[model samples]
Target: MSFAALGLVPPPTFCKKRGIEGFRSHLSLCGVVVGDLVSTSVPRPPGPVPSMTPASRRGLISWAELDFRAYVFGAIRNERNEFTDAFIKQLRLRPDKFVVVSRSETDAGQWLELFGGDQDETFYQMRSRMFEAPMASFNNRPVGHGAWDNIRMGRDVLYSTGQAGEMDITGYLRKLETERNEGWLFWLKKDRFKVKYLLILDAQPNRSGIQLIQDVAWAAMCAAGYVRGAYSIQKYVKATDALLQAKITERLSWLPPSYALTFPVSNHHNALLKARYARYQA
Candidate 1:
């Protein structure tokens, strides 16, 4: 099912002007937060939108987290058109199961707490709750001043998880090396417990932000025996639907140098550890 099936339509105020050029400009405005954070312009001219080959598209889900209602209402109708059929065919996932995290819920603290709690909560439940959660006044800029949608969804949800230093896992996401704004997706397990794939749209993320996601993702993968004693890791970037896998060898400072990789601590936590170690040495 397409976004149309979801009965979600762009608001009346959606850009009145039509055509690819207008949508491209709207996409640029939608990326204001990202551009502001990274101090770079967004949505380079809408040249031919790239397409992903069948082989590269395998194992990826066609999903995106919901933007704040205001942005959703403002999205141009044409933007709702998705290239998810291939993504679904390859992954064999249902529309609901092929879910994206949403910006509709601002108070992700409670959701994170409950989900992170020891109590038994399935991924299905988490997805369901995210879909059902209420939307709030999350747009930083006034409507019409700047666009809000995909980029805003990722920014809002990630920041609300206390990734912005309010609670634990504090650090801001740095700009990825690409010019295009991204759509988010995931690769969840068949059991629907652990997250097997984290298809973030941004490349060249901040060191700390990448570290945070890596640590959490590694923890989950380790719990599920997805990683053997020694395993290699590869990074990828999505060009349109294409998943461009990279072949490079650069060790992350926080990650252990040994072949057997270990999780890294946050920069803040690492500093505390260093201080305590120095005091102990004294």
Candidate 2:
């Protein structure tokens, strides 16, 4: 069955139980308690809409995290109108899972407590609760600004590998690459590693943001905690429909690398991984 058939929309229970008051209340409490610990930038942009540099249609998703520190931009749509089916079919989706995290730069201790409480739906519910208002605010802010559907807050710095300081996973370390590089050209090349990502929901503004998306997606697929399903691609009306796939693919080609973290991964991620590693190409 298709993901849509499975009712992939947000659970209605979340809507009924967590009212505006509840989300805002928690935001207030978290904001107040963590205010001294963390800081958010003003909600508006710095100036008028400057001319956008035509970024290569590639290099959107990061293999590692969601922050997208190396590249900075907002995607307007996921499907492009100009591309044809034959031209688009040559590309394969990248294979990689993003790491999702929910850390407060200000309250590391509490953030740890929230995410460390066993790997389960509670983790997502907690994060969804934490990010709900901010997410609503961020998503809605786009409406007022224009017909567009996005907004920018403060920009995040791409910290050096060593700069991640304590959160460093040593094995994943490249230790020296401090500034996040323009990843698309490097990642989407004919012969380089390929992985899509999902960012964390907090909008860490790092590649980890993509990782966060992937992490949460995996969590969602858990029919039961005991049944940790792998990522999978299905014959959806979208993917299977050539015209639709081409339109959607061309447009979303610019999605932040972490955007892939939200894709219908499963077997596809495994294949992409195998292909990139040269073990048994997907």
Candidate 3:
């Protein structure tokens, strides 16, 4: 199913214009950047507009925690669109399992509490429990310093090996438990819980953001039953007149059929003037 099937559509303001080019033009006014050659073959589903609801209240059931950072960069480098397809397909198949999160949710404190370690458990203890959990019930447990340090050290050594490589080091580390590796043993207790999926949203479209997403994805994958799809939506901002420049410089390898929002940037002086004028009117 397409986004249209999920009740997404261009706003009514843009609906008055005909065809894809018109849609793109309208999107620019809102600061959304769409690839010039977007495919329009996908059909929009017909229905009355639904009432708006807060994302946090959506009550979507996620099996795993998705790292938005990784999902966006992965999509950028996804020349073949495979990554995009994997993401969208999951949404179509299990829309109820995904919830959109904002950039604020990426805060270290919140992430640590949710996925890493908080007051309740150490990072190693959390990892050990998650590894032991079953697929259907996997979720982030507490993370503490010792467990995280052990995993990080193993990852560093694997990367340093060059031959063993850093790629898929999380998966490799999971394998270490089978080998009874001294360092990993502490966090490899027999447990049955595991994480199923992670859905992250509003991640910044930058290198650091990409690393964050990758790190989250890797952490989830390290557990057993690593599912194929983790979806994310990255937010991009641009000045009103810089649409063309953005289109040229920021080439998305696979432009998935999705809604875009364009927030026009204004000079600081102009913004201040407008704010003052609004206050004066009030």
Candidate 4:
């Protein structure tokens, strides 16, 4: 559906005020017209509000903002290589589902500089932004200070992994990936699932632009992965585990039969039964 069909088209004066002539021109090239709107404000039909948990709300906010950033800046390219609009498409998300409140060039440029740069630079910057003071704290120290310092000081054991000692960052990440690819049922049974650690790992460059945007989004959703009030660790774990399952399921579906046999349906059922029995036993 078109923006006009959804009553999202802005009036000429509104577009002029926002200096969106360039965006309009770009949309025109895509065969989308924004000239039919007469009202200054877009009309919306009222509907019942959907229920959402705090973590879900935060995740949605993060996803929407990052999706908007990707949509706006996806066409830009530097001297090294040409960037493509591969984010939303990769995730199979509809572009119209996102509602961006601001489309200022300054905001887009700032986000691009923060996330679209070198991987190492992006990693540390995200660390400071998401895990350091002003964004998060526990007893006046950064919530992730212990883990961050351990990684920085080359300590083999990290706080995030609990009893999983003497493991480097690479090993820890590999373990997380293994659990994720095994599926959400496997992840639920693991004791080392920590939202803070997952956020830290999310900050690291692992995939494409989607990873960078998700890093920014997850940080924004719950800084340092700390939650209060009604938001619990279980809720955070479930939310993040859903994202992990989505990331891995795409590849799982295309695996060869030999590889597919590794994740048999019976194993999944057994895992579910074990989890339920464990919960009852507790």
Best by lDDT: 4
In candidate 3, position 22 carries an lDDT of 30
Shift in Å, residue 263, candidate 1:
39
lDDT of each: 0.23, 0.24, 0.26, 0.27
lDDT of 1 by residue, 178-221 (tens): 22223311111112332111222222221222222233222222
- Could you give candidate 2's per-residue lDDT for residues 33-103 as a string of tens digits? 10011112223432222223432345321111111211111111122233212111211111122112222
Question: Which digits, one per residue and each the tens of the lDDT, describe model 4 over residues 124-175?
Answer: 2111111212322223332222222222211111112434343323323334
Each prediction's TM-score versus the true structure: 0.17, 0.18, 0.16, 0.18
lDDT of 3 at 122: 22
What's the distance in Å from true for residue 95, model 3?
33
Rank candidates, lDDT, best first.
4, 3, 2, 1
Q: For candidate 3, what is the lDDT?
A: 0.26
Query: How does model 3 score by TM-score?
Result: 0.16
On lDDT, the stronger of 1 and 3 is 3
Q: After superposition, how far is residue 47 of candidate 1 from its true place, in Å?
A: 49
lDDT per residue, candidate 3, 181-205, as tens digits?
A: 5443223222332211122321221
Error of 4 at 76 (Å): 12
Those runs of model 4 whose alpha carbons end farther than 4 Å from true positions after fitting are 1-231, 261-282
1 or 2, greater by lDDT: 2
Residue 119, model 4: lDDT of 30
